[model samples]
Target: MHPAPSVIFFTVFSGIGFGLLVFLGLDTFYVTGWTAFVFFAIAYLCAVGGLIASTFHLGHPERAMKAFTQWRSSWLSREGVCAVVALVLMGIYGAGVVFLQVHWAILGHLGALFSLLTVFTTSMIYTQLTTIPRWNSWLTPLMFMSFSLAGGALLSGNVGSATVLILVAALIQIVLWLRGDGALARSGTTLATATGLGHIGDVRAFEPPHTGTNYLLKEFAYVVGRKHSTKLRIISIVLFAVIPVALLVFAPFSHLLAALAVVSHVAGAFATRWLFFAEAEHVVGLYYGKR
Candidate 1:
């Protein structure tokens, strides 16, 4: 819940990258030659760059390779496997489309499926954490997928579809916030429950866990003030949804305007992702009496 910049970038950019791959794999645009090359380049850059960024968040980046072996049990491991499979499939498909000008329909469709699966696995990594009630919801996956698809639409130059999907993503974001606001309380977790002392009596911390901050406090117990959160929510919605939709629907269509919309959307994504981690109420916070 520390809102590490690397993780945020990984989720946002990789989601967008995979989303773009979905559209490309489906042959949404008849891109060929240099145009296809540019599209694939952007997609690969975002996807691969994000994966690389994620390594920096690891305590031992070199050990990241071990994550792939836990695919049967760990969502994180599943994500790694899916990402590799999706990238390889998409790479082959992209090469054919960009250089050979051949649309390998089967390969493209499979790549798209794996790409989507990769995003799902990424979301599950968060959603599976019951310790964080705010993220332990089905809506988390929906939110991720919606944003990815919406961003993909924007990048693919489908202005009409992008407007609608972006609007939907905004609505989902609003709903997620609303639901997450009470998720902690609704989870029935408290100092009593956390310490298994509810049967004894009312439980309260008599003293601090320590005189100074520690790793748990720095990581899982990070907090954001309510007023600041509200302001950021507004900013995120405006940049992610309002401006993009307004420009796409009302402003005269132009490549520059579309690019601006993409930029605004990605910025908004960063804000939303920051809030996602910062606002999470980890059950460990109850141990510190900080939630």
Candidate 2:
């Protein structure tokens, strides 16, 4: 479970895009049907674009089709399949809105439902990875849901209450991350246990297998100093969560202020996402040379 920036960007960016699409689809049921349809189309396109960009990080991109073979046991496979289903649904819904003049109560609702299911599938991709203790939590899905909604709200030009909710969710995630760190420290385990250790104290990495950093070490084994991590955590909570919420709450009630809040929230979300990846200690890291 190395921190793949490509995958990370894909997840976060596409989460935002799909969330916005869901919100727009939901709005189609209201008086803003045409506007909602336009936004939905744009959001769906962005999500698909992000998905395509994610594949560039894979070494064997040509073999990406093989990912769908393990749907029975692999969450990643399920995610891929679900993403395809959601995209198809959204495309049909968009076409109906554009050409057939379809009502929102029918196709729009179906699209929204599929979008939500897509979010669930996407969250499960990380949540199912038990080797990453930080991600193996109910909060992972909750965080994904909240952040998606937050991004959607911002994109839809409603940054008032949604930003506050996002802040609250981000705070909760930060607390959960702290708890996870404490749990890992108290587990009384070492890198050896992660490789293949049955007894408690019979785990130690006296000598690393390699003298220089390999791909595994450079990826999964990356670590930040405790002091820097703590500082970054505080900054993430403040700049990404608290301050943005404050701006959304009381930012002179001007369009310019709302726009600024949206920008701040997006930037903050990206930073928070990065920390989420950086702070996570994959069990695979133990197999490498990380402690």
Candidate 3:
């Protein structure tokens, strides 16, 4: 599948934002009072900002309202609705934490549930795309959920716990990507299936679909060499997951290191996420002249 930078930023940035909200809600649940209100506010802002940034990817931003019309069948529509609901609930949750103070527990629980729902909605956006085999996995949602938790923990300044969780999530994502790649390499199934050809026999594209790249090719035909992808995977694991875990576990507690680890994880995760999109063999690519 082709990786849209806007979509990638949307997922990563919004995941972090929503993740932070989930953590803040959790903090309210266990730690009490309005101390976590500021964090919740930050979480809400990030979530909104990420959502807005994603709009830049649309060819017709004016038609964005049409997205909500297909919520019955479209995961993208559902994601939009879910995001709005999550934001609204977060607002109410924040209000309760600030003013009501009495229903923090109730609102916190609701926020956590919505956070999980938000992750599910995000995953569905990919998983429902039968055209993208790499994303059609139960692991996709888990990866999203794990990353959300991992990011939330990191942003919350609980480096030790976040590091452990992020590593676990990163390992899972790595395994899933490897499995998807192997499937693509073996059957030629990816490109074939994407083009609606079910046979296992050899297939190749001889003529180009267009003189210039179209939206589909630009968005889905992205390719990266296997060797480079492998190197990036290793780097991502180390920089985003393993090393951060080590630093959080062993290094002297310093805000700088914690902050750096977050930066590294975000950058590394973006790379990993890009690889996820690039390495994916879209069924559409077969029709577009890729073997």
Candidate 4:
């Protein structure tokens, strides 16, 4: 995948927003009045902003609303539906807390369920892509959900829980990278198999598919150097998990320190998300002898 910045921002920020809603729905923060308003405002900003960002990737952004009608057959549609439902439920739940200081336990729980579902659907958008073996794994959804929960916990001020979730998410991140590295090969998808010419003889492209670049090459066949990938992985893990955990455990707890941790984690998330798309080897690239 080309890893457009819009998609990366959408996944990371929207995941965090939904994660925060999960906690709010569960009454984990027990906030009220102006405090509750602030929390909900941040959540909505990230969630809605990320959703809006995704529209830029569409060739016809104006037609995006039609996606919601295909929920039965498209993960993208399901994600849109789930996001709208979650936002509606959360909005109602948030209103009660911000205005009346009342905790509508049922609405909160429902909102949380839908919010988590939205994240799951978002992950499925990539996970369902058989063309990208790296993302077509159970670990994809797990990684997405874990990071969401971890980010939500950090933002929700659940230090103890955030520390544990971050550690778990980090472990998952490492495993996802390891597994993804061999996914294409493990799937038995090679140039020979792709063209169904294995029985005839050993097949190899004698010449380039075309002289110049095309959409496939620019979008699905983008490549990253191994050395650069390694460096970015290390940087992502450090920012995403290590520094935040270290600060939380070793340093005296303070608001300043918490803010730093949040910043570091979000930065790390961005790096990892970038790598997620950049490193993906779409099977379509095999036709171009690129993957």
Q: What is the TM-score of each candidate against the true structure?
A: 0.98, 0.85, 0.87, 0.98
Which residue runs does candidate 4 get wrong by more than 4 Å? none
Local lDDT at 201 for model 4:
97
TM-score, prediction 4: 0.98
**Tens digit of per-residue lDDT, candidate 4, span 146-219:** 99999999998888989999999999999999999999999889999989998999887667777999998899
Once model 3 is optimally superposed onto the true structure by TM-score, how far is the C-alpha of residue 68 displaced, in angstroms? 2.5
C-alpha lDDT of candidate 1 relative to the true structure: 0.93
- Whole-model Cα lDDT per candidate? 0.93, 0.70, 0.76, 0.94
Please provide, for model 3 over 167-270, each residue's C-alpha lDDT reduced to its tens digit, 9 standing for 90 to 100: 77887888788777755455445545655554767556757856887878776777755559878888887877877787788899898988888888888888
State how far residue 121 of model 2 sits from its true place (Å).
1.9
Deviating ranges (above 4 Å) for candidate 2 = 28-34, 98-101, 186-203, 252-254, 287-289
What is candidate 3's CA lDDT for residue 80?
85
Query: Candidate 2 has what TM-score?
Result: 0.85
Give candidate 3's root-mean-square deviation (CA, Å): 3.0
Clashing pairs in 3: 2-219, 2-220, 194-283
Residue 145 CA error for candidate 2 (Å)?
1.5
Q: Give lDDT tens digits, candidate 1, residues 138-199.
A: 99999999999999999999888898899999998999999999999999988988889999
What's the TM for model 3? 0.87
Give candidate 1's TM-score.
0.98
RMSD in Å for model 1 = 1.0
True-vs-predicted CA distance for residue 88, candidate 4, Å: 0.6
Give residue 29's lDDT in candidate 1 (0 to 100): 84
